[model samples]
Target: MQQSNTYIIVFTAILTIILGGLLSLANQGLKPMQDKSIEIDTKKQILGAVVDVSEMSNQQILDYYNGTIKSIVVDYNGELIETDEKGSPIVAEEVNIPKNFKQQPEDRQYPVFIYHAEGNDDAVEAYILPMYGTGLWGPIWGYVALETDLNTIKGAVFDHETETPGLGARITEKEVQQRFENKQIYDENGNLESVYMLKGESNPESALDEHHINGMSGATITGKGLSDMLKSYFSYYQGYIEKVKSEKSVASL
Candidate 1:
């Protein structure tokens, strides 16, 4: 027996509705897990800049992040921004870096994360700056932790969306990042010279001088991108940095 046109239309509509509802419910169920994973990964990246997080579990990362790290948002002039224009409180971790990167520099929100060693909440071990830039194939970003002097690199950790695996992707390697440790970002005149990378392989002793590191053997473009990102962010945070330095100088008087 042949079905009537109206019956076929009605059955198709019912199937479509049921399928759509199931899809929506599935998405709702998965959202929380996705958000949680993102949060844990972000915490790991931030913490990795100041300390070793490779051996940490997910819960450990969360606990250490909540317990030892403090963060604040600042504006272009490096003045603290307590709240958004609508009066809601601003959070450093919640600041969207790529979104802010699209906005004008003076209009963007900068997040500064301060790290405190375990058992000492009153002392700041390092100041971590978030950095973003363009790589050979995609976006690259990282966190750089500066020592209490705010001029010496305490540590660094970088990531990229898509770059040549063996060449530019090496930026995410621990050894490559360690190359930046203790490298000074200031010149003798107290100027913020920042740091750069040479074109090819070199030893740590030869790399750390006034302000340069050894670039990956075949990744000069990505290397330049890294240097540019650091210098640009450092200049952006110069206001806050100078303020801190001034206060410290006064305290020593």
Candidate 2:
């Protein structure tokens, strides 16, 4: 009886060790695939902000991003910075948005992605900006695509970590996002009045109409958070936008 009990304990120990080793090995083998999946998902989100990528395959998304997107890093003074030895701007994808957001606005390295539509020689189709904010449940983030004029919104795509399914999560819905289309971020006086999600329905003909969009009914807090996020990020990009406008004005003269 004593010998049998000892053997049972030894067997249990060996089994536990074997199982632990196998689990570790599995995790190690899957790490590369997991990282690849995350990379693909991020690329898809970025592209979706500028164009319709819902039907696009992984390869197609990657191809489109690599072919047409030009990434530029700019400073608070609106000056282009962080170039390589060849004097080319660093790739925007390499800029860590979350980390940069944590830094002071002027100290942050902002990533701007310029998209060129097919056959449009040297002209920018849209500029994509990254935004992050807290939601009811957790972190909510997205990308906003601006037209060349820098004041008009061309498109937007949002995603959240743990927002309520039917409420705050609706921000990711097509209809909700479509409301931002053609929205103006700046007022006629050239003031930065960032676009906002109103608590109730917006009056299209109202003076503040260009800056307002209808908010989700049951998600007022989430809507406010989204509005604040857009305002803060747009303010950060103001310097670069102003620089671009000035350059264009000079070129036209």
Candidate 3:
């Protein structure tokens, strides 16, 4: 009996080490692939915000993505610079600007990407900047694409934390994301009016009649959090946006 018990203990110890080592090895081997997948997914999401995704298959999306998307890094003055694939500055501290940009809005990199839809040079579209923030549980991130006006939001995509699985997590769903499609971001007078998240069955027409989206019903907190996140980052781009608007106005005249 003693020998049997000793054998059982030895077997358990060996099994534990073997399982741990296997897990460690798997994590090490999969890390690069996992990161690559995430980067691809992020790029896909950013592109999706600018183009129609339903019309193309995954591979076609990727092919068009590789062929058309030109990523560039811009400084506070909106001047382009050579940078990483993510559009961050090559300088170490310069890249760190976005992390604390809410306090020092003038020091952000301002990533920009231009896409030529359907391989047509005439159909070029631009997406600017990416946003990340804390949701109720974990991290929430999104991409916002601005129209040439820079006031009108061309499209937006949002993903979020580990809130109540089906309820709060719905903020990340496709249907909810679709609500921002072609949503106007400014009043008719062209003032900078950001989108808002309404509560308690608030109809957009009645509540935000001029320019805002109705908030998610049960996930109002998430909706408000998203609004807050936008206000923070969008304000940073104000100078650049105003310059674009001024250029458009001048061209029209």
The most accurate candidate by lDDT is 1
**Candidate 3 lDDT tens digits, 10-31:** 9999999999999999999999
RMSD, each candidate, Å? Answer: 3.8, 3.8, 4.4
Clashing pairs in model 1, backbone N/Cα/C closer than 3 A: none
TM-score of 1: 0.88
Off by over 4 Å in 3: 1-16, 54-57, 83-104, 118-123, 188-190, 202-204, 246-253
Worst 10 residues of 1 by lDDT: 201-210
What tens digits encode model 1's per-residue C-alpha lDDT throughout 1-253?
9999999999999999999999999999999998999999998999999889999999999999988898989898878999999999998999999999998888999999999977576688999999898889999999999999999999999999998999999999999999899989889999999999888887568555769888999899999999999999899989889988998999989
The predicted structure with the larger TM-score, 2 or 3, is 2
Q: Residue 42 of candidate 2: its Cα lDDT?
A: 86
**Residue 98: error of model 3 in Å?**
8.4
**Model 2 pairs whose backbones collide:** none
154-195: candidate 2 lDDT, tens digit per residue: 999999988889899998998999899999999999999988
lDDT of each: 0.92, 0.87, 0.68
* Error of model 3, residue 29, in angstroms: 2.4
Q: Per-residue lDDT for 213 in model 2?
A: 83
